[model samples]
Target: MLTTRPERWDRVVDAIIVGSGGAALTAATMAHDGGAEVLVLEKASLIGGTTAVSGGVVWLPGNHHMAEVGISDSREDALAYLRRLTCGHEHDPAVLETFVDTAPEVLSYLEANTPLRMQPVANFPDYFFAYDVPGKKSGGRSCEPLPYAVGDEIPEWRDRLVTRGTLMSLGSNTMLAEDFAEPTEELKAELARREAQDIRTKGAALIAMLFKGLLERGVELLLETPVRELIVVDGSVIGVRAEANGQSIFVAARKGVVLACGGYEWNKEMVRAFIGYEVQPLSPPNNVGDGLVMAMEAGAQLANMTSYFGQPAMFDPEISRDGELVPQFEWGRGAPGSLIVNRTGARFANEAMPYNDFPKAFGAYDATQNEFPNEGPGWMIFDQGVRDSTRILSMIPGRPTPDWVPVANSIRDLAALIGLDADTLEATVATFDENASQGRDPLFHRTELGLMAPGAVRPLNQGPFYAVVIWPGALGTNGGPRLDTNGQVRGYRTPVIDGLYAAGNTAASAYAWAYPGGGATIANGMVFGFRAGRHLAAQPARDI
Candidate 1:
């Protein structure tokens, strides 16, 4: 276990932040910069939570850097995109406006105040059905952090900075699977070294840079500190009772308490009860909805409790020693050569869809077939060409892989090995190969037809086929305690609960239907966190 010195006495800060992910850090930084003394509490030994384990990209429309690169986007276009994505969900219009309007400001602030850097990845595509909207630039306005270094500024935080070796990375576009597939051996070697050294890649790296800036600004970090309960006096939240190092510590927040503790992705009971599906989570194991519980207990009204984002994951009943199922993204979905199939041995969705949408599609497939939602594992079928050409991102325990599977001579044999229907599997492969030949996928419209072999017109013609069982997994649960446009929690028949705020995945998302692009979750988190901080900092402590 990790150790930290408990500070003596009873001093109050302007804001108390729980969780150390991008949301928590961003909120803390904004509050501190706004002239409020801020204290950040994390449950893990390190600062970065799930954000550290993610691709460090933020989907910001009309960002300054995008304009600097000659990619012109207007607030109208962004609003159109969001409206198409949300499709009449019960979202606050002000919150949506604030997200787009303040995204560039937040991007600018991070670039100026933090060690994080930004570059636009103009090639990434939005996950929405490509035909639904026009003028939606195929990968127009996403930003990745620059390579940030710890640089001996905070020796105490050296090991605590979630780096790449922890299966995470900070800034740098090359960490993305799309970028990682570069054929250059030198680039591959560099990535390997960076991963070994725990150098944070994408989101993790960006968050680490933010954390470095926070440390430089004399921000205090309290880790392994779980906020046990909220101290609600009268109608406002005043403080938090946290368990730090086996001792109960009452930390007063004069300005407010921002709950960024993330969602209960790993809490199986919560997942089944709230999300109505069985899921293996790809998020950090530590997210358990502590903030949601604390705030709900204090009478915060919850919204959108039934919705959750899902992804495809390879499943192994006993992949982890702790008996927890693991979700593998890079190996199962990101690999270029693989394709997913349902129990009837039919491809269900576009393999290239964003990870979150894959499982949603799977859920649809399950509903169509009258099967248990996400209970029946899907199959990921690939060929030797994929095994030879693609790189498998390391699989964590509990996620299934083909490492133990035997290569089969034909589709029929492969289906037999995996217990799939031989004729159905053959028909599915034939249609896919035919569609690939015509440079079109009629079923799912998967782009990137080149991954399929030329002249291999049917599944029966392929040799040494491979298959792995997959299941519905999630990055994190998206629904939680509902907050107003200002990140203030709403109480029972009350306006705004002052001094109590929530952001990140812990708060209900404004996006109700489709995720627009990559890095959207982090973007939402950072935007709301900053919004909460600024709003709270401007308020009087007594009112809070």
Candidate 2:
């Protein structure tokens, strides 16, 4: 935090929003619409943050659109479900209640004030659908933006927007959240047509819709501009010190500075300090904790620093993103002929569980041994039957296995090659196969085979086994400065930092340790971003 103002202000606005993800952009729109001159600064050259490359679903319980999908939600029901999930965590009930109460309003605002037209993901089950948690519904709390044609609708911004990662695996095909079945010929044709028109779907669509609204409102957005510090005037945050074109630029924010720049997974030191474990992030490479550091420097109190939106991931050496080898999002772990085993070759978690909760099980600690027993280099073991029938990570059925992947003729040989105990590995497989063939997982109590198709469990009895080292990864870190109900950053010395606000992954997560549904991250960020924008806009402008 910079206590002294610059001699000359390079630019001034009513609100300066740091970062350009869904949360930042939502705040920008809200502040701009509230009659504040807003400026958005992005660290990456691309306009969309992690949200652009994500699935772009927004989880909002009690949303009006839930009725369209034959699901009903109430504030009480949403709270009950959230409270149950957060029972043992250090989550704030007030913040959770605020998110539950304000999320529906935020959804309505985005639909009404922006070009985003979201529809309920019909029949898309919540992450905890099979769990015995009360107030949990099978589906309908999640919503996704309708596909938007950025190339046609916003040609000027098309080249600058981030491409959707889902396109990488699906061959650029697009689908609505409701279209879960295998793509038919007609569906394929429609998707091809949409692609030809440069119509973006999922996260890109969500960003494009919000971005379009921002552009129409004449809100200024600067890409490749990263904020270095917050400029404090007296006790209030009055501006930001940013860098653009190799020059330091001081931009004054009359009302406030909203730090929505995302999480710090890419910063190795911060990751080691806060998350005490390795987390291969699946987000864009720009989230390096700029907002987090600045907020800390500004005397902000932190919470939930150890939590993240967890993902069980397998790194593919052949695959790279932004010039680094990123872990492939785990796509094959829950397949019929697959199981995840620890270094001792013992199966640990319910492989069919939601990605967030599934990875948490990997942290199973042994007090007597003084170590995390299920920690990484854990392998996702699969048989030739799965390889012949499913697409495992980057491997397509009938295609030769990538040379980087380890393969062997039997489970024992595979375990030997991966440094696991051959006897334990073989025995584990035998026990799993017997119970799986009987359509019961007595060990993990797994209820589903895979997300792609629900069917009876298939034993991994075939020879020529394969193993991929699975790591405890994350979509993004969800811990940082803690925020109050109004989205204002809390201070150690004061009740609230006068003009400092934060939202999204930069703030301690609203859900605490629980991932409620598919788009909960996006929804929580937007709700608080909306709240911050409105609250900041309503405040009297501070003098620089």
Candidate 3:
């Protein structure tokens, strides 16, 4: 039998937060800072959840950091982006407006009270729709947390620190393959050295930085503890019943219990029922919608169940265990220098569109052919130039370059490898290559269409061309319990569920169609988490 920690019960916190991802941690920090005793319960042995494994950038438009750098942004522009993206997507306007208006204040609070710092991801464009929007910084607004301060200032969390690529590093930029072009031998050597030294990179570094701050503030984290149900008394949420160390621990919350546990990305039954497809998930394994189930049990109404945020993710079915397939994030099939095609040997939507748009478009493609959603495995094709110029991170074993199988010297050969019609594949490649040569992809209208960079370019004439099968994978499901402006759960015949709140992927997102930025999910979590914490902390103790 596994040795479990002795069961210890406590009911003294001002708030009890489920899931220690960005949302939960942010709320815990806010409640603790507001003089409320906060307890964070995480089902995973590690605390960060999906946030720890993600690209640690948050999209905060009109933020204080933007002003610090002399870039002026307004609420109007932000709202316009929201309107353009959501476009009749069942989002509450009030909540959307609040997210835009109060973004700066949330940034201010974090800078003032926490170790988290912010910086803009320069030159990156908003997925696509905001290309012509005024006052929109090309890359608009994305921020990263600064490195953690070393020493015993924060305890125990050091061991729990999450690192990228299973190592530790500091001040490393989360650049895509394009970002590493012309990587000097010195830089490559340095990266290897860092990898050898076991430095934490990207999201891992950011989570560790935030965890350090939470620890310094005396916040208590209960890992491997799962909240089984919410404690509601007389139409108001009072606390939670959790499974901790093989015992039922009932923790009372004088303020509120914030649910930031992620969506049901890994729940196969829920995904097939709700999303209408079988998709490999890109989020952490623990995101099984425990919070959503608990909230629904307490009468929370859900929204956007038919929709999901999707990405063009690399798929390897053979490596799957217990019906769960691993998803590759760094190797984007539709990044700058590549294009995606369906099994019918026809190019579908713009591969360069945001990941969310890709899967939705794929679903549309499947619908057009009267096939099951996500039925046709997608293909990514690129030239040797792309191979040399881009940093394509693949999992092929013992190869200096990222390995892409199913390659051929001719379209017919490639088609045979990918199981596509020979003539159709030849015609498709001919048209694509013609358009690429002339800087015009008429079919998909890929923006900024151009030839592969000089160094990264390899002629398609090379024998043995490459292809990889892809599927509609997701970071997480977007649909969940509907939340009001103040992060309160909504129900029929009720204005809002008092003392019940949600944040992160558990709450329905404002961006239902287009992804606003790379770190928008984390931003939503932090923003709503802060709002829910303050709103609950300000409530009278009797509201509990």
Could you give candidate 2's per-residue lDDT for residues 199-275 as a string of tens digits?
A: 88888889999999998999989999999999987888989999999899999999999999999978878887887
lDDT of 1 by residue, 1-544 (tens): 1012225425577899988898889998999988888999888987789888677788888888876667788889888888776776845777788788888898888888888787876466555535456435555567777655453444566677765522321224255644636558787677666555545557667777888888888999888988888877766778877888798887788899999998888888888788766677788788877877887777788876766656566644435546655566535453444677888788776777666666766555244757753344877788766656544443333445446654688888888888878999888888887666665666665653211111122232346777777777777777877778788887875877778899988888767544777778888889899899888888787632
Worst lDDT window (10 residues) for model 1? Answer: 449-458
Give the alpha-carbon lDDT of every model. 0.72, 0.85, 0.70
Give the total clashing residue pairs for model 3. 13
Question: Top model by lDDT, which number?
Answer: 2
User: Clash number for every model?
Assistant: 16, 0, 13
- Order of quality (TM-score): 2, 3, 1
- TM-score-wise, the better of 1 and 2 is 2
Q: Stretches of candidate 1 above 4 Å error?
A: 1-11, 125-129, 165-200, 315-325, 330-338, 365-375, 392-403, 433-439, 447-460
RMSD of each: 5.2, 1.9, 5.0
| Superposition error at 540 for model 3 (Å) | 1.4
Candidate 3 at 188: error in angstroms? 8.5
